[model samples]
Target: MSDPITPLAKANIPNPKDGEIVAVAEDIWWIKMPLPFRLNHVNLYVLLADDGLTVIDTGIYSDHIAQCWDALLAAPPFTDHPIRRIVVTHYHPDHIGYAHSLSERTGAEVLMSQIEHEKSMALTTLDDVAFADMMIKRYRMFGFDQDILNALAERGNHYSDKMTKTPDAGYIQAGDRLTSLSGDWHIRCDRGHSEHHIGLYDPARRIYLSGDFLLPRITPNIATPLAAAVDDMLGHYFAYLAEMLTWGDDWLVLPGHDWAFHAVSTRAAGLIRHHQQRLAQLLDHADHAPLTVKSAMDALFPMELNEHERYFASGEAHAHLYHLVKQNAMICAPDQHGVDYYELR
Candidate 1:
């Protein structure tokens, strides 16, 4: 089938520099690597500790990233000390892609939040096959054509090969203090973006490794189709934002994407404001007559969207619309074709 969206190569974003490590702090390095989506790159962190090296996140399971890892493992700094543990911030393929491979190569234990580990395991199970099919139907209900639906399902199944083989060695919970990698890093867990999104905080350095909780440029998506109970992604997101504001301005934020920066408080405020603005825009565009979710999505992201862009755009639009409906600001109705329609309440 012809791809609905242009391939990453045609998107014109620069391929990530090969195997270059940017130092975010003393003994803490950021390894920016390529992702096969509209988002061009993801930042994986590495820390040199007294015990052994700790890799915070692994890049996508692509040949380029594999080669980059091979080079890094064979290089001076990384070669000197073996990796002690492979710690994943979340279950997202971009963050945990090469984790299994790295563990196999170095005999490193893979540590992740219990929720993340369970979700990852479920996605690759036979029981998940029915769920995957149901997801395809749900996307179709949102007005996506068969071609796009197929692509989405294919991408979903692709995780079986990309993720690590080892089960989580240990589960890290919220408010837990980790003393392995650094002196003491606090674990903060939030929902909405991913099932068990984990962030690390170093009190001494005043640094926070925000997996996808607090990105600098773009807002982390807060939509979950696979949530067990009520899927209140926007609610989870705003609550997380409130939690982030409790931090001091002096805290340095090392996000999953974008460059590391200071001003965590300000960034958290800006993200909250951005969501408010978006919700207002959506409400204003939604009139008395019911509007399909796709119409609302186009109204927000009017630029010509390729397949890859549409993937995220559709999910994001659904997230905002779902939030509005829950807040009683909007209503969801279905057309005869079974497509969902959103309207102002």
Candidate 2:
């Protein structure tokens, strides 16, 4: 049965506010840039330094975003200094979309984690035909219908134009300390969410730039993508949570998607508990009978679904099921149709 589309779109809707520069500290400011996706904004940071300015996380490479950057640079706060460096938190399109262009314009050297830089460059050259075929085969193995599978195949091409060109240069590895106008920021790297997602911590100010690792209102999506060896994403996610929890509760969190908050410990605890609840729910469903990934997704997200939701739902379900299988709490057996049937161990 095809699910309705209304709830999916509504669930992923993005809320954009009037653009403003927020002073995070004495010489640091954050600018929220617009994006085209349902989660329609990204936070870009600017640091006023003695030598030059540093801009972090340029917005997606659209005409509108380019104009926004131009306007801001022309304004008073940013008019004096040239951008000496562009520090990207990760390689996501929303985070590094205008990196190449901005680096060219400002002569800023782009800095990112080595793992993120390699992954980002690979995305730029992904072959559409091969990618679509892989999506169809993966969905078929999970028991999605032809219609839903077809939609998933074409969705990637839809957003290809929004992706920015890869950076001219490469990345800065973890354990490298960044010194600028704001002083030294320590880089901490973790996996699970995205390969080698980098978070910056300034001990002096007790602030953490926690890219997509932590969000206030919504849970971060943990999906099992094709051609990835780390199939147990749920396990990796919990490990990442544990790593972040060690940063102490009092530190202010600067997230990629949500507003800045000081509840790092509380938010980390909540995320861990949320995943526990999701695992329990999956276990209960598996105990009743063997379930296909598609059926499990429908059970977990029992609302109107669309092409986007369907794609995400399958990936999320696969992540959880793979984790449970690894822990011996669930067993997956292949049927003649080639779909995996999962049940409680």
TM-score of each: 0.86, 0.88
For model 1, what is the C-alpha lDDT against the true structure? Answer: 0.73
lDDT of 1 by residue, 1-345 (tens): 111221111112222354677655556777887776677788888877887778888987777888988888877558788888778998888888888788888898888999888877776563435655766766777777778777666565555556545355578789987664455788888887887888888889788889988776677776645535537687788888887788857777778886676667777777787778778888877864566657767766788887656656767778788889899988888889889888877
How many backbone collisions does model 1 have?
2
How many clashes in candidate 2? 1
Give the per-residue Cα lDDT of candidate 1 at 181.
44
Q: Model 2 over residues 1-345: C-alpha lDDT tens digits?
A: 122211111112133353556666676777888777667788877777788787878888889998888887787467777788888877777888899899988789988887778777666766676667767778888888778777766666432356667786656767888765666888888766676787777888787787887776667777775545647877888998887677666777777876777667667777888778778888988878888888888877897876656667778888888889999998898899888899888
- Top candidate on lDDT is 2
Segments of candidate 2 deviating more than 4 angstroms: 1-17, 156-159
Instruction: For candidate 1, give the lDDT of residue 214.
Output: 73
> Which parts of model 1 are misplaced by more than 4 Å?
1-18, 126-132, 150-158, 161-169, 180-182, 227-230
Error of 1 at 175 (Å): 1.8
